[model samples]
Target: MPIKSIKVRLGLLSIIVLTGTMKTLGQANDTLLIRQLAPVTVSATRLEINEKRLPAALTVLGGGRIQIGQPQLSLFESLGGVAGLFAQNPDNFSQDLRISIRGFGARAAFGIRGIRLVIDGIPESTPDGQADVDNLDMGAMRRLEVMRGPSSGLFGNAAGGILNFQTENANEMSLLEGQVTVGSYGLRSYRFKTGVQKKKFQYVFIATRNQSEGYRALSHMESTILNLKLRYDFDSLTRISILANYGNSPVADDPGGLTLQQATENRRQAHPNNMRFLAGESVAQGRVGITFEKTMGKHLIFARAFGTKRDFANYLAFQAAGAGTINRTFAGASFQYQFSQKFDLIGYRFRLGMDVESQGDTRRRFDNLIGERGKLTFDQLESFKNIAAYVTQELTYQKVTMLVGLRSDAIRLHATDYFLTDGDQSGKRQFSRLNPSVGISLEASSKVNIYTNLGTSFETPTMSELSNNPTGTGGFNPDLNPQQAVNYEIGAKTYFSQRLRTDVALFDVEVKDELVPYQITGQAGRVFYRNAGRSRRQGVELSLNAVLAKGLTLFSNYTYSDFRYREYQTTTGKFDGNVLPGIPKHAAQAELRYFTPVGIFAIAQVRHASLLYADDANAVTANGYTVVNLRVGGQKTWGRMHIEPFIGVNNLLDAAYFQNVQINASANRYFEPSQGRFWFGGVKVGIK
Candidate 1:
């Protein structure tokens, strides 16, 4: 069907549903009508402070809003339009999705290394503040909150910002929700969730099964997930909660980027035997947390502790006709305490907190090809700890508020490496840093605010960078040091008559001792981690939203980046200017939604990215591309049950492109190709 027709039909359906509901309410009791007409949100703030008064850059995605348009399956995809945020996934099954906030960690390959992800106050980042959201299940979430800029002082290690996924409170009677989807390339998925509440106890369970033939050959994947949460309230001021999650992913092939000739030949076909030569890894992760809260007259106290563990095995094919397997184990614990009061000196609200975290990682690599067989194996163990304390006081006077926070962090890093073949060992190294931040907000009116912030953050070297042994591909650099950054931002937000909203932000970041891989001669061209010269990145982000009429809404966001190196060390040991790699100059997204009378809705989305350099030397660049998507769905009531069905077309224009690339001196480049345009649709049901 045509996009315009879809929108027209959905608009009519929404009108019908609204009219019918109004008529039904007229016949019902006054109390019932009042209950049904109540405002939808009251939990925007965790505490008593008015949400409209908070001096922070925050965005909230409610569960109902998420279900209205039934946005993309990927949570990152759905977050595309948020200011200063960008999401890119090369393929559906790939664990490596690129996410950049305010130009931080834009070059990360696999997981987000600088951002912080939290769930119900449990820290999700590793000890050094690195986190990957590969295991997050968005279906069981009640809401998602994103706070940009350095939030490390509030939650340690959140240098880039913080993303919090809050699960539904199971204490609301009993409910069940599930969804089944089938689409192009034989794709299928099933997600089920159930929750029960009784007295002071509550429990929630979730399970998911997904499989797909994928858009490229040998790119098939199968995954299973399970989540369980339990909560108990001993008293009005005391509560305890526990959460556990497990996931398994088994799949084939790395749908690597292709050359120009290869892409022209066939975009859907994977390299020969890509599937047969593919073997996937299995990952399992879990966390446990405890919280305590107390109210003392005019003051409140909050404290929490948590521990997490993750295990994984990833296998890959090497160039020398050998397969390598990387086994990893990660574990960590964190604790924090906060004291706050609504009124203080100068009629200001003050909050002070301290956070401490420690984590350890162990990685083992096995190369079976060249061998002394098992004797040639390599192993490494690394550990890190972060300790930070901060105090934030928000002074409110009339319509103006000032938020000031100062934090200092002490980080300790240690590593040990062993080469099984020759009993060679590498020494350990340690590093530390301190960061601080300040912010301000001014309410120009009831619906408009202006804010600004300045902060400092740093990223320490990881175990992979400091301990990997040379195997013709890459070698470890034991002397690598930490990378440091300073960021400044100014932003404005406006809400027009509760029907339109807009936000804009400008940010600049400067860094020293940046980390980059350099190839060494005569050492089989092994890439080693080294500290690059100074660099700077600046960007502007704009977001706008409008509710057109009653059942139509539109949203859009755009970002422009200017990133370059002030001085970079080349192979000849000379300092030179070069542009940073993996950063696009421009990116934008727009989305439109329409509601119909038959409980149906339609949505259209478009995304565009400008050209980007693939190498630090600025010698290679990838062309830009644009993609479009369309989705249509509707909900119907069958007796006392509700059912919703949806169909979506991604990459409606069928544009072909590569998400990222690695350029080498030999003119041999490696690319991670993006999937072509595809179609998907699904059905969802709920019970209350």
Candidate 2:
């Protein structure tokens, strides 16, 4: 269908919905019983806080809400409608989905940058607050909260924001849930979860196995994951929890970006001969934590401590049938204390926290020489440590609330180069920064609230930027300073008749000495890192949720952004004044759902994104595309068994488009295409 027709149809649908609201409401009330539900969130702070009352822009997705959407493949793709956030599926389910919050980390293909990710109060991101959630199982989650804007003063290095995932707990005695799905492309998946709770002791185990032939040729993947959680409460005020996860997956090679003509010619075929490449990743992680809470009359004290470790391995295939592997290890600890009413100040809350993290990575590059040829190998190692402390206070006076926070971070880094012609050597670098933030909330009325915030954040250079061998590219930079940014935001939240909720926010960020990676046209195009003179980013975000009469819900969001380099030199260091790459000028989403008797549900979603440049030089631009999706599902209960079957259609209109592009060394403009129209159906069953 043409874009014009799609828009016309959407308009017609909207008109029909509005015209028949009363009738539909009556039918919905008679056919399906529904009730008003309160919004749930946890990301505003470490504690459970009402989202409406929080002095920030927050988005929450409850477990039931997510499951109702019947997401077949990537969880990120399922959340494409969030304001100021974009989720892209480059190629079917073979690769990690690309997620960007306010265009902060769109460059990374396998991992997330400039954002902090946490699960069940344990930091899932690396020492610098970067994370990869490719292995996370959304089925076992209770809620997902997204906090946007500057948050370094609260979580440390979360320049963009934070994603907090809370897992389901065994609040009952025994429960067992499982799902088995089979769909197009030879896709098959199995998820099993079971938990037992007895008094103060509770345990839950989850396992998943998935395999797919993918929507494209040679794009096949197989992954297995296991998660275990155990919790014990020694007393009413003390608790201990332990969690572990292990995952492994083999991925197909990138088909390389395609042009418009190429995408139309062969939507299911990858680049010729690309099947010879093979790569995979594996992860092992675990965490142990304890919480203590005590109350004395008007005073309350809360404390927590946690230790975590993550191990990673990555293998890449290169030319001459040679291969290389990268290994990384991370360990961290955190401590926090919260004191309430310490001085009898009404509605006063104070919190202090500290964190320490150590990380190291080793890379081994090798080549397979021909017969009678000698094999060559080289190795490099890099290590880094980060320490941070923060303090926060919140005071509520009547309908006005104020929050103030301050944080300090210290970083130490070291690099050791071995197997080099110059012999073994070591280098060190250090950096520190202090950040502060303040926010205010005013309750304009019983159904409306206004909020404003001003905050500062800093981003430290990654180990890859500091110590990676630059011989092939431009050689590593031994001296790199942390980037600093100031963010300002204003927003308002309004609730209408307790049925409709809306939020609108405007924000701008200015960065000084921003680190940017660029390529130099000297000695085979070497890649190096440099700091941009300056940059500015501004945007507006709007989100709305409506619970219409009769088991119907509507959610919509839109964002408009203006990102550019304020002062940059193109000649001296290959940096020029240009629009930042990968950031869309405009994005929007709309979703509608209807619930019916017999436990049946139907949903439709539409998404749109504007054009964006592919490279820093602005020589190539990728055309934006709009997509539509549809889903239908039903559930039935039979005695001790319950079964739910769902079917979903993505890219319903089959609009062929590219998500990103870049100028590669081959002088070819490679583009990553969005997934074509695909269909999937699955069933989930539960046993008690």
Candidate 3:
């Protein structure tokens, strides 16, 4: 089916649903426990604010909603309800999870780019705009804020969006907890957590270990993580926080992608090349960060500093120099000041901030001799440094609020080659960018809000992307430059009553030098990057939450994307107007939650995605699929201890689906079969 037809059908369906549900607005509010709905609060824009008052699209998830009766494996498990966000490859730890917001991050070959990642008020992404989620601790997650759309004015490079995560702290509660989980395919997990408060000090700590035999051959993994959060309060107006995280993954084998026929024959089989070369990855990473904030009357100050180090090794399915290792160190700091004043009928607040960050990588490549490292082939040191300053103003008058932001960034990229056999390839690249954004929101009434915004963002190619020079063996790919975008968006939030809430957002974006990925023949697993001349991305997102009855709740969301290349040409082909690969045109999710006064809870979820193309040529398509999942759990208190047991069944209908698709893969190896009918059960013991 054509994308236009699908869009039309979805439009009709949305109208019908909205119209039918809104008819009941004339009735009285029937919320049983309105106070328990947990209103969403957003802080991704550098300040704590009400969602309805913000001029951007945002989604929030509480700790229980994200962790309860969940596998706690990857972000894919927690991000299902966020519209316009697509996540895949949950089981492929070697590549991390492929996450794309709107269409910005669709080009990432490994880890994440085109988006900003924040953890406990500190940046988690590297200076060059690359982030890996293997170190994120799902067990300690407290609140998650997903800010969708361009935000470069506030966050600088790769700010197509922001994902801010705040973990649990002892200030909220004090507890000691332990959990053990077992599942199919030789799965085992153990977690221990503790939180305590002493006088003005509070701390929360968590440790977890996970092991899996995987559903595919040669795809086993074992990893351990530790997280610590500490905070001190000097009265209510001043505070300091410390966050530390460490992760070690000794083994994470990769089951290389397969062709459709190969997957159809035996989905569990690993690629022959993968088995021959022992494809996989190992990562040992750690980071420490500190944040301080002070407020006095109408003035506020904030500061943050952090450092991270990573030792990584990867083995691919190809032979000649297909293995690589990177010893990376990254550090950054930021400071901000805010002033507020109130007039007779209007109020305004202003903020000024500055940031400095740097990243250095000692990278080396070697031949993959049947999973063993061979002779060294290439060696280089790559570094990226950044300095930025930004200013923002927020003004309010009656029921109207306006926001304006501007930022300037300076960046330097340098690399030094150690392998002289290919001649000296050292080089440096510099860039300076200025970005601006403005937005306004109107409280039409007590029950509705209308908002609109225009913003621009940029994403510089990562050090890894520049080092993989497609044309020759070199230190940096001088041709690979930064990608820029302009986004215009409008949205509305409505509350029929205490029982129903709905959000609708529409966005249009134009991109220049859009980054894209492709694989060269004979380099089956190695990915190369290139630029598309121009592209246009437009999307409609809708989400709703309803307290259907006393103990039942309904939540659902849908995303419709129309992304295509406006003018793009390459040696392989001319993709003047092709549907962007790796993202479905239509994606939707529906979840039902049933809770009783007794302490028992049940959840049923259904997820669907329309078929999407796998390559720029649009000659091959990945079939769409629907997956159903069910979870049930109950809580019981026993004196000073609370015991909770839960079980979950994923893909209840045993649907045939692809967990991941390697975009523009060589030899048409694009499919990674998803697991079928998986079951997991666990028990948690906690004391408060």
Candidate 4:
């Protein structure tokens, strides 16, 4: 479909919706009151506190909204309405997904960087700030808390912001549920969940399997996930909890990017080299974690420990080193104590904590002979260690709150080479820093909050970024230094009435030595990192939720990002004042949903983005596009069973665009065409 036609249709539909329903209340008054009165949050301060009192830009997505008539295939589906956040690459399972918050993580070449990912208090990202969520099962997630802007003062390294995912705990009522779904591109999924509760014990188990013959050629993917959680309540003041998870992805093909001419010819065709070499990845990962919490008198104590292991193998076309195999082991622990006191009308809370984590990887690279390994090319052992201590204080004085925090971290990297035929190259590096932040929040009224914060953050290059140097070095790149930045932000969350609510935020960030990647000559798939002199980032975000009519709700979010380099010079040319690559300057998303008394529900969503640059030079551009999607579903209750049937159509207007782009890609191949219009339908059965 033409861009103009898509826009006109969407504009017409939106006008019709706005005119048809504009006189109804949002959720029940009681439910709204309960949610607004004392909603709790833990990600901002690392402790439970009222959401209105947190001096930071935070948003929470409840489970009900996340899973309502959704495919649950990627986080993009759940977080599309969040302001200042962008999720991409949902169709390319080989690379998982790309997430950028306020343009902080837009420089990533592969995997996640410059952000922290936490699940149930366990870090999914490595110490060096690299994360992959291919194994994450969205079915069991209960809630997500997103902390925007800089947060390293409390969370240590790579804390540009935090993505915290909380899992559902076993409830007092025993329950069992199962679901099966089939979708376009031969997609299929099955999931099962069960929970049990007793006097002193509770347990929950979840399992999921997903497979797809992807929309594009040579893009098949299959994965299985399992999770188990157990809790024992020794007493009212003490509790012990344990969690275990395992994931396996035997195959996830990499279709590779296509040039403009190629994409124009056939959007569904795979790169010729990718198909000839059978480029793909295979992965297995497992983790176990335990937590103990207790309260004694006026003091509270918390302790946690965790261990994880991963095995990964991948084949790439035209590889310099060869096929690769990586075995990684990671372990971490944390301890914290909190004290609270009250005097007259003032309340005080003091928290002190420490975290320690270590990771080691045994990496082997071999020459690629088409789809098979030809010979051993490189072998190395790489390790990273991090230790940090932090303290936070909160003061509450009648309708106002103040938060201050300080942290110190030490990180070390080590590498050992075993390929003696080349040379015995061993190297080590150490980095340490101290960060602090302060913020204040004011409750202007019963339904309004104003908050502001200032903080410092530092991010070190991940091992992959440091190891692959264009100069063909075997060890870490000594030229690359950690990036540092300072952030300033102000925001407000206001409820106009039971019918409407909104969140608005403005942020400014100044960065020094920003890490940037450049493609190496003759290495078609290789990239190297260098530090830019300085950079500036500023943005505004707004999100709204409103009730248009009795059973109709409207949600919309918009972001305006003005990000560029203040001083940067490359061998090719100067890039000062050029827009950052891979991020759009203007983006907006809107959705309208309706519910009926008979349990029928329908939703329509529209997403739009402005043009974006493909490289630091600003020579290549990817045009903006608009996409529309629609879904309808209903539930029916039987004597002992409940059934829900749903159907979804994506890209209803058949917009032609790229779902993912390779930033600064070599050879002018950058676009990864998005899947065209597709349809999916499924039914779920369970006891209600």
Candidate 5:
């Protein structure tokens, strides 16, 4: 099938949607949160407040919208209509999902960086700001909240943004549900969920298995996951909750990135070297966390502790140090206290919190002898430890709210190289940083809020990045320095009516000593890091959520980003004024949802991305493209039993596009072609 490129008249569509919402009469705001009609509570900023009252840009998606007639593969499935957010590489199991918020995480080679991922008050991203979601049980996700812009003032280190997730809780008496799905390209999935609530004891258990031969050759992946949540309410103001999860992925293969010529010739074929080396990853991971909360008078206290262990192994495309294994263990704890008081018409809230975390890794590497490991090349023990404290104060008077926060972190990195033939590159380093932020929100009208914030972020290179050693030795990169960024943003939220709403924001970010990634010639999969002098990022975001008619709604967003290096100078050339690679200059998405009286529902989505560069020089570009997708489903209930069946078509227009681009890749290999016109369908049955 050949792909066709097209454009959408988004301005005209926006006008039509605005006109429809203007004529709707107030209907008591009793609609479900998924409709985006009711106000939502947001906790992504560490402060519980109304989404409309938060000074920062925030997006809250209810669980209902997240899983509606969709493949439970990635969070990108539900985040299409969000501004200033970009996600790609859903089919690349080795690299995981590549997500960037406001261009902060665009430098990542594998997994995510800069942004923080938190699930149920436990940090999913490590203290050094590295995250991998391959083991995450997305099937049990209940809610998602995204906070954009710098946020290190509250959440220490690499808090350029936040992704907060909540899993299903025992909200009802009992629930038992099962679902099985099969799709194109040998996709199979099975999921089961059960929950029960009795008095002060509640528990939720979820299990999922997903297997796929993938849309590309040598891209097979399979995983089995289990998640459990247990809670005991002691009292209304005092409670404790425990969460546990385990995941195993025995077969995950990497197709590897390809050049434009290679992708155009055959999009489904794996890289030749990747096939020869049997490139892929395998993992066994488990985690457990506990949380406690207590309230005394106008004061509240919260505590959390968690531990995790993972055994991982991977094979890369090259032979030198291509086979790698990691035995990793991590543990963390946090304590927080908040005080509130009211003085007539003025109110104040003070918060203080402390966190400590440690991670250790036993890493070893061997030569990849054409699908088999040969001799040991490198062996090392690496650890990262961090301790941090934060304090925040908030004051409310009349129609205005002001918040100020400060945080400081002490970080230490150590590595012990046991490969003595290499002269033993054992080393240690320490760093300390302090960040501060402030925000103000004004209620200009009952339906509008004007806000401004200035926030700062600090990011350290992950252990994997530090250990990549450009010299082909086994030690941390002594020259790689941490990056610091400051962001300023102003935004407005307007509720034209209960059926219509809009959010607009403008932001500017300045970075110093920005970390950059590049590849050496012989080491195909190895990524080496360097530092750029300075960089500047400016962007605008606009979003709209409108209930156009009774059962019809529209959610749309647009983003314009201009990111560039201001004073970057490398040994090769000066990169000043060059555009950042991997991120598009313009991106937009529009989604329409409709429901019929016959228990039928439909979702239509259109997304577009402007041309992007694959290298810092902007010499190589991937053409712009627009894609459409649709999902249709229906549900019915009969005698305590519920059933739903759905079908989805991605790339309905068969638009030619690249699903992922490897930035600054050597040998001009960057493009990862996307599948054209994929189909998926599934049925679910349950008793509640």
Candidate 6:
């Protein structure tokens, strides 16, 4: 069938389905309009407040929204409709996944940078502002929140923005659940979850195993995850909580990028060199955290501590001078207290907090001889430490609320080389800064809110970015500097009708000493960074959610970005006013959902992006494309057990496009072909 005809048929089908739904269920406005009152949030300012009253560009995804497409494997599945955020590379497990908020994290080669990730109120991002989301157990998550724009004044290092994930907790009941899923390309998954809640103690536990044969050659993966949460109530006013998580991935294969010619010839085939080198990675990680809270009269006090350990090994397609083994440890603690008081018809609140973190890595490199370690080539120890103190005040008068915050951070980084045959190389560097922010929100009406804010943020280079510098000796790059930016933003949220909600934001950002990465010649898996002089970023984001009829809902979001380099001089030439690579000029997402009283649901979605450059010089580019997806499921109950089944189809249009790209890559090998049309189905059983 022709692509155009398919698109037309899909549109007609949507209209027909919606019409039938309205006719069957009629206009049930009262039921559809029944929503939770004043959803509470903490990511915007680290204080629990109504989301509508927060002065920031924020998005929240609950389990209902995230579980629409069952058996979730990647964050991209649910977050595609969030404006100003981009998530890709779901199939490339070797590089984990790529996520950028307003173009801040686009330059990362592996893991995530320039963004803060918090899980269950504990920082997952390291002291140097780097994190890997691949090991997170999505099955254990209950909600996620995203705060876009500069936020260094609130958080600490690399606070370009914030991403927080909260796990499921025990309620006032006990329950057990299990799920099994099978899909195309040998995909299989099994999960078990349980929760118990009592007067004095409560607990939640989940475990999962996943394996995939992959859509492309040499891209298979297998992993297991476990998550546990425990809470004890000392009294009505005091409590303690503990959390533990572990993940192990015995194998995650890497297919490597393909040149344009290779992609055109055979998109399914892996790079020829990958099979010989056995390119892949193995990882194991564990984490634990504890939290204590107490409330005394009008004051609240809280404290938290966490620690993590990780072991990693990898084999690259090309042989160089390293062993691919790494051992890392991270520890952190935070303390805070707040008091609220009112005077002369005005209410005020003040909070004081401190945070400290330390991280260390023991990295080793060895020669690769046909997928096996040959000879030890390098050994080193690298560490980063950070300390920060902050204070915030909030004042409320009438229908307006005002907030101000100030924070100071001190960072220290050091490196030690143990392979002294090439001469001992040791170095250290220190950085310090003060960040400030101010914001105000006005309640335009009962259902409308207007907000704006001004803030400053900073992002430091990750350890990987400071390694193997081209212009300096091999310790830490002395020439590299932190990127600083100032942001001005305005936004509004309104409910035009009982069933319609919309949010819109506009922002202008100015950045200095931006860090940019370039691939070195003849280096297959190595990357270096340099500080570009200046840049400007401006954009608009809009989102909408509406209940069109009794059982049908509509959701849509759009982002328009205008980002450019003000001054940049590269080794090849001077390229000024060039469009930033890796971000689309325009991107959009739309979805239609149908739900019935019989526990049946269906969703149809569309995602589109405009053209994007692949290099800083704008010499190469990737064409824009659109894709469609569909999901359907139903549930049945018997006695105390419930059974559910689901099916999904991805890339229904069978569009051929690139799913991931290596920006500014050498040898012109940039494209990672997307998986074609695929289907999956699964069944689940639970008891409550």
The numbered model that scores best in lDDT is 3
* Candidate number with the higher lDDT (1 or 2): 2
For 1-688, candidate 4 gives per-residue lDDT tens digits of 3434443443454344333323321223334423532346665468678776898887788775677678777777877777888777888887778888877777777777788898888889899888888878888898888888888988888888888999887782227778876777887889888888889999999999999889899989999999999999999999999999999999999888888899999999998888877888899999999999999987999999999999998887665575888899999999999999998999999899999999899888887778788788778899999999999999999999999999999999998988778777768989998999999999999889999999999999888888775666577888999999999999998876666788899999999998987775445455688999999999999988787766677888899999999999988899999988888999999998777655667889999998898889999888899999998776555555655667778899999999888888877778899999877666666663
Residue 597 CA displacement from its true place in model 5, Å: 3.4
- CA RMSD per model (angstroms): 5.4, 6.2, 7.9, 5.2, 5.7, 4.6
lDDT of residue 168 for candidate 6? 87
lDDT of 5: 0.86
Sorted on lDDT, best first, the list reads 3, 5, 4, 6, 2, 1
- Runs off by more than 4 Å, candidate 4: 1-40, 172-174
**CA-lDDT, candidates in order:** 0.63, 0.67, 0.87, 0.83, 0.86, 0.82
Cα error, candidate 3, residue 6 (Å) = 43
Clashing pairs in 3: none
How far off is residue 253 in model 4, in Å? 0.3
How close is every model to the real structure, measured as TM-score? 0.86, 0.87, 0.95, 0.94, 0.95, 0.94
Model 4 residue 264 lDDT score: 93
Off by over 4 Å in 5: 1-30, 33-35, 172-174
Position 175, candidate 2: lDDT: 80
Per-residue error (Å), model 6, residue 432: 0.5
Candidate 1 at 59: error in angstroms?
2.7
The Cα RMSD of model 6 versus the native structure comes to: 4.6
Lowest lDDT sum, 10 consecutive residues, model 6, at 21-30
lDDT of 6 by residue, 1-688 (tens): 3434443443454344433422222232336423511245565577666778888888887766776456677777887868999876888887888888888888888877888999988888998988897678777887888889888988977888888888888882229988876676777889898999888899999889999888889999999999999999999999999999899999999888888999999999888777778888899999999999899987989899999999999887777752378899999999999898998879898889999999998877777786899887767789999999999888988888888888999999899988787777778888999999998999999889999999999988887677556653557888899999999999998876568888999999898998887776566656688899999999999998877877777778999999899998877877789988988999999988787665567889999988888889988887788999998766555666665667778899988888887888878878888888877666666786
Pairs with steric clashes in candidate 1: 10-595, 10-596, 11-596, 12-597, 13-596, 13-597, 13-598, 14-596, 14-597, 257-671
